[model samples]
Target: MSICKWIAAGTLAVVLSSGTALAQGNLDKLSSFQTTGVTEFTYVEQGGAKAEAIRKTLAGINLPDGFSIDLYAIVPDARHMAVGPQGIVTFVGTRKTEVWSVTDRDKDRAADEVKNFAPSLAKAIPNGPCFSKDGFLYIAEQNRVLVFPAAEFFYESPDVAAFNVIPQGELVPPEEESYNHTARVCKLGPDGKLYISLGQPFNVAPAEKLDKYKKWGIGGIIRVNTDGSDREVYTYGVRNSVGHDFDPETGDLWFTDNQVDGMGDDIPPGELNHQTAMGQHFGHPWFGGGDTRTNEYAGEDVPVEVVMPAVATEAHAADLGMHFYTGKMFPAKYKNAIFSAQHGSWNRTDPIGARVMVTFIDAEGNATMEPFADGWIDENGEYLGRPVDVTQLRDGSILVSDDLAGAIYRISYSAQ
Candidate 1:
């Protein structure tokens, strides 16, 4: 990479990740609209054969001492979730075309109502749903972004107020549209900006496509104002980062990236990256995963300084959605730790990573990971449920979404 090309890319990343760059969303632009005369919203039944099957699957899950798991809701293709700040609703996104709103109307710690959120709007791969501390909700789709004001209250109705943050065909170039590696995940940064991760649509991004990918914020994470202004690519050199979160203590961003495939099952490992600065690049085509260099872009003059992962998880683990555990329900040892889901391997001879993982960060910001929950794979080597994402409830207990089982399971702790 030439100095000029690197500088040109880093310039925008620097400007965005810099502390001085702050969000300027037009809050006044958010207005409530009713989808009157439209009432064909499909609702998921809380009790039935499907729910019983999910409950039976949860019975075989393994967790640590003092922890328990229960079937929270029956959701189809549930990917990532955003528990409403008001404690009235939880918005769940899916790999399909629907985002479901789940509500525990009785405060029973289990969802009572599960229905499509914005059934009137056609969503394309709306897989990530996140909320701001002040009640704004953001959903990251494959090729667009949308927001809802007072989503907690409006989610009860089939038609909630919806507005485009990054309109269709604007989040990424329409010509580069793809279905693979396009499930975007999003979160609100401390600076009140919306940070969305764009997965480059390839096993290893091509050399010719890297420049264009960086320009369009593909294969990297980008931040924009709440109203979708002042867009900038914050992190670069990432390959299909499906999950990330900010450290509540230091405000630093951490993410998990799916590594290169077909390099044998155990050579190039999966990554849990820590980004502490602007324009920081996590090795992608250069280093497949960790220090293992890629076979595609071999012998190339590597230019930018690549940020290695804090922890190189097992290869082919397929680590997906993650969140820092900030709840009070668990023991003090778990505070500030990270809870992430490994969706398990797709093509490995022996499957791995179909469970929830907890990583403890030491005082020096170093991280170590271990299996917090597992046993989702059956005795016959079949996946009972593949965990996708983790989020905390108001009660401090955490909820995990499983797309394989099409359900959300709640993990709460109580002294035995």
Candidate 2:
């Protein structure tokens, strides 16, 4: 298509609306966005009634015989986490505006401080924070991408160096912004690019939005250069993926996607997808999840060759965040396995999946998933905690964030 035709096809918004983001060849002011250096940061109390209550819920959590779980920090609306490359601080993002800086200053496994990072800047749904191998931290907000150079080292101060990779109102066309399915997740790919997921706004995306979604990478994953240039859609047909990680050994991209809702109890399963090559499509409007066809486009011919999921989990369990286990603290059987969290169900008749899952991969690259932790739900079906994201610490132990409980939990294993 000619450049004129591309603009005429409703994508003029890509140029007209995204001024500083797409129009500029380079970031408007790279490494210049900084805060006011306000020292009065609001800190989450390490010891309090709330902390004890969240700790008490640990008794109901069941892990492997030699594994144990404990409260690591107190955070509000913790969604996804990024452990700093230097292993000093762990940056946790939330669906709300703040990105938390968590530190265990005493090296005691439990966090000694929980405070907001970059207090002077305004952030919208900064749900994904990832770090480069060297030190820079990149945060994926709802409609913006910001980078903080040496964030782990500078987080002790209220003001940290920041830059706009993709400026606000530019990650997606501003008009497509919605509350649902907007929490993005990002990772620095093996190719040295930043990969970010852009979710379509609706429960089941409408056909009218398909063209624009394809053009702007809505409902798909898009990757860009570290400076936010050379942006393009990397994967297609994803509904909404809040969790993704690269295979430690293979460098393949694996992600967990939430399937279409309002389908009956068990019609369409949740998805754990593996993308071996670029431009692969996972099923969306045509097939809800697995082989289940969606009601909206049942009779229509599917547009793209859809890549089936590596694992299909239970329906309505809401698979959210995941991590590829490469830690040495666990047994050899778990070396390259996948550890993921299910945030549990909302509209199901009998609630299920408020637990952590372990997926083991074989020599043939096949996957088998089983529950690694459970019992976050009560007998009356009330959720005591909802696990959002999983990440490993420098010590090789893993941390799980619970948004419902507003706390981070540390899980480790020790042979007795």
Candidate 3:
């Protein structure tokens, strides 16, 4: 590669590896609505308004002055985003086993093209994609990881039928292992393995909960070799950790666990935890954060042993995607902070989360949660957009995915 190409590649790599930029959590937009010239985009739903309708961008969001939000991409069931080969923005469609690619070729910086990077298997649902050093893409679907080449083929088409590279590491623990329906793909860190977030399938289980979870493949982070070998359970007792990333500075793995339902609308806030050791458990079903559990699992010393989240969000915020900030666009204080997406809640009497949140980490590695974006949800709990994943661009600007609108918003900074 030429010198300029090398520099561009390095910059893009830094942005992708930057993790998450600081944003807001729980969708609290504290702004007055302007009734004039509000931009609105709508789509026709499949069966009816209640069916799996194609949601579009609406007017209630309150954006900061000088910062404008636009329709970035129109993807089908787009969920998560990662800066993939050639700086292309890649996202996952949960219902299918296909990895969708979004690109901005006109230099307008808006995503204008869409294609599938990899196709799905009969019963698999693609969750996330992570790139390797050798220009390979490891995608996580239902129960396995599919490796694909062409880390930089932007104009060319992707060959999903050719993926055969499997993980080469230890297998996940059989006893606690359950075939998780939604598995997230992530590049293994420090240990050089592929880490998959395996979520528990149920909210509550019987006294002998072993059979329920172990049989279904929920509640843990599993690590295996890139060649699809030597899988091992890194941790257990996790609920649904859809969004997870490793701290580039410390090599510690961090994940956002969604709070369980039926526990009252405003109880037990979702958790952000750090994996300090192997096989560590974080009080699922038995113990919870925010409000302590009164059940048999509660008042016990088990959840206590597991390190509490670096920060505690509002109850039922439904925190999903998380990334650590490693860019220079924002202030230096935000370098160690984490950016997370709060997928709006359905059960809350009034919707709570729908924007990105920032978790500030101190010099000692401690963390505190705060808001970064505050306009996706309106005052009356009306949601304008639901942020799914966060991606940092090559220029340090942050890209947020709104699955509700099938769009991506680019966030940049400029001093007045």
Candidate 4:
């Protein structure tokens, strides 16, 4: 079709789809364009208005004083990341089912080399990672854990033949209607066990079903030995916890629980929970976030002692990547802060979160959630990047992985 005719059709389509003639003017203004060099492209307005400078793919990031952030490396489908000894940053990509190992050999704190750490079938959506002292790597797929023996040699693991893959045993008991599910894994716990999160599939099932499933155990954290033994439920009432970590300071286990959706836009915000005791319920189908009841499964009374979240994030924030800031690169106030990446939300009509946030904690372990870094969610509901995970480097710098933009960012601090 001729350029003029193509422009005319585009204008008419826009007008019809918008149910008004308001879009026709903009369409006509963008009707004419030009091409320069073979690799160069440009769009020219018919009214002779100069083209504006294209916005940077990444902008609007806000960090504390003396802190700066930059794109570390370009990674396709990079989702969650784990930092290893000697500045090794490994990311698990769910879409491509590929794990990437990044390192900064030049010591600039940016990943200079990206190597394919592992590859799996399309069904394998790589979730999270934990490392053993023997250099073995533990990664979570959809519903299982795969052990990579001596994963330190990932770039040289010839033909994938040198790596060992092991699947974890199921935690749900036999005859149980519910099954094991989730995308989370924790380092071998203090008990030398690997703690895994089992997410409730449905937001809230019928009371009868809940009663039946509770008898067999469902919706909670499950733990087993590193070799996958002594399987049992650690806690219940968690809807879907995507992030978990063991505190380096207190040796306590901390996790982030995602709230159930389909609730009102601002009712039940997500949760930042700590495992106070075994068999503790953090209020799933009954009392929701902020101790507010959903009234869905009424009369199914939750225990009064059920623990509340240590802190509350934005509603439908899709929180993930709970790592405590024990590194020394930041100010004194951030020494014990818990950092989490809010992956943003799609269930809400407007976006809620898509940035890295920090929760400052005192020596007594009291915490307050506050915005540490933002600018991933825009006023117009556009997300520039979705930060999935944050990892600490040896030098105290931190790396954030954006699954949407397929990029890793390094955040560093220096006093002026």
Candidate 5:
């Protein structure tokens, strides 16, 4: 055999056996290439007929008056997004193995390039990406948490510094891991701690599993220091929360909880909850979703006080990623409003969501939600795009990610 063939076989053997550890070793080969400046990189552009088709789809989307939606980039399976400081790059996560880096080098609003961020490390459903103000990028996976120091500067080459914040199987026990509700979303709280959502692995957690679930915070949000210290449950009794954000003004946490299924299609509504303090429980097993009681725990006595949702959305809208609008480009009325994505529903006789919704907060902290952008779901119940997460850009525009269509869209406002 040729020398090159022998080397390739050896490399494959190591990768198949050692996995990520071997992959990390291979990244050393690219260490000599320094990633110093943003201008040095040239990103691949999204154009041609595919871009035109995406544009056509965007034209059908309906936004409020004076607002327009444009194709920001064509990202595959773009589950969640975390824009880097100054919005130099947008890091996107997915339910699959790869995380993407979408860059707009010349500040054109449209992405100049969309490419895999860190191709060296073997990832398991890296669905959540969050960046600190100081330039640290963190990704929350199914059963692990990884931190990439200075990810914005060093993402060009594969030699980016990577460390585990929470090692594999430590986020949740290996025995308790399930295929369901493992799409974890994370964010850096105003308190500077890393908050992660651990969705319980069941529709209605069985009675026997309640104790373990509470202990591990399997159905709740967990917070810890950036270094993974002082881990504790911030809230409990949540069925499955795929999206959450800290209110920029109040520093309070708000999240979207996917309510229990199997209740009649329209009986139990999804929730947008407010957590004022720690240890608060949002009714789950005791009350399946909203005020509807679960069949399993219907007659059981409530163990703790339940905090009702701030806003009760249409049942099975599959509400996900939310953000408080702090951009100046929009009208003053939209300032501090909550913008969220509804990924749409399955198993319902009628389809719902698949668009963006806005929530207005009154002086007394009361929230009222209304549709801000629609038309993703057609009259025949077909989904043109399933919106997953909503994020903001430095240019004061909003970016919405769609996992089904594998695309990210930019929503901007203009008086004209």
Candidate 6:
């Protein structure tokens, strides 16, 4: 059968099995040139006993001098966020089935509303949200890609038009799906293509699975047109890169790769990689984390040239979402620097991470990673909040999403 027929049949099977009527015909309305509804805003109350408790916790967060952190909104399982063109609304996604719409409708710089975005749609792990300059909102799901037209305008109601960019089961084979590394992230590259990361489901993929993973682009980043055609692998030899972004200056791709585990805590280091050209392989199973080879691939000959990381972070740091600071709210030294979230370590004897990191890129394309905002891990090794993704709002403040706290925090700089 043709690919089109196969896709159609697979889509039907998925719809029938999932008991969801998200058919192509229904979503196709997203492509139409119609604006059908009046935009409405919902205001969320920010004061309560629970709010006071959260605010008290925020006091423990430490940042640079002249910086303060404030509670932005109470969003459950907030993962990644995409701010709209005019900064009127911020669309957030999660590792679960819901995408949230957050708005500061009164322009108070504090969110006045936070609610599910298009709650009518049956979404699965809609963890990645990217927006085009022209009001097109693309969400990368675990097994699908969806585009919402004029998401900011029609987000208040459930009638917002959404079209599938990559149909279900096309991102990765359904059989290979696993709970590990299934939280996909996406970004609209400067070249106008949508880039999605597909993390291979393994701590260190075995040699037997290397070829299959490469063939499926399972351990790499894939790119395609805005319409979801011409799909191709952009990079490979990565274990599980949950976060990546294009450099604003050179348009090069830089990503954070979670290193391999069970290597005595400190043997293999987490990676911050710079991809200057396409198809460049970063050492993965062969070199396990940074340069330490895994037992599974020991003594095996590496076929391709491995690209060394720009910076090697501590092992098990679990670096996730990242963004380059381009907002004017911060000092000049912070402009164009990278801010990433270290989701904290789980397997290490002494937990390390659960904070935000800053990487300054030099003129020669080198990176130096350092702790930016910490205090998430207390002296007793307890977690206050685990930072997931870092993004900048229109007014130059930085927003950090914490899944553990189920809230988003805004970091603003004010000189004393």
Residue-wise lDDT of candidate 6 within 1-416, one digit each (tens)? 11211111111111112222434344544446343232232223454554676788899988899999999987768899899997889998999877889989888777787767764466789999989989899999889999998899988775587788999888898988888898889999999999999999998887788788888789999999999999999999999998899899999999999988898878688988999999999988788887788887888898789999999999998899999999998999999999999999988999999999999998987799999998888899988889999999988999999988777999999987
Pitting candidate 3 against candidate 6, the one with the higher TM-score is: 6
Please, what are the lDDT tens digits per residue for candidate 2 over residues 1-416?
Answer: 11111212112111111112212223332255423434445566677677778878998899998899999998878889999988899999999878999999999999988878876566789999999999989999999999999898778865577788898899999898899999999999999999999988888889889999999999999999999999999999989899999999999999999998888999699999999999999988788988889999999999889999999999988898999988899988989899999999998999999899999999889999999999899999999999999999988899999998888999999998
TM-score: model 6 vs. ground truth: 0.90
Whole-model lDDT, model 4: 0.64
lDDT of 3: 0.61
All candidates: CA RMSD (Å): 11.4, 9.8, 13.6, 13.0, 5.8, 7.6
**Alpha carbon lDDT at 272, candidate 3:** 87
Candidate 4 per-residue lDDT, tens place, 156-248, comes to: 432221221324233343343232334554566766777766566667645666665554345677776776656677877777787777777
In terms of lDDT, the poorest run of 10 residues in model 4 is 46-55
lDDT of each: 0.86, 0.86, 0.61, 0.64, 0.85, 0.84
For each candidate, give its TM-score against the true structure: 0.92, 0.92, 0.77, 0.79, 0.91, 0.90
Model 6 lDDT at residue 113: 78
Model 2's lDDT to the true fold? 0.86
In the range 257-369, model 1's lDDT, one tens digit per residue, is 99999999797899999999878999888999999989888888778899999999999999999999999999999999999999999999899999999999999999999
**Candidate 5 off by > 4 Å:** 1-45
**Which candidate, 3 or 4, would have the higher TM-score against the true structure?**
4
Model 1 sits at a Cα RMSD from the real structure of 11.4
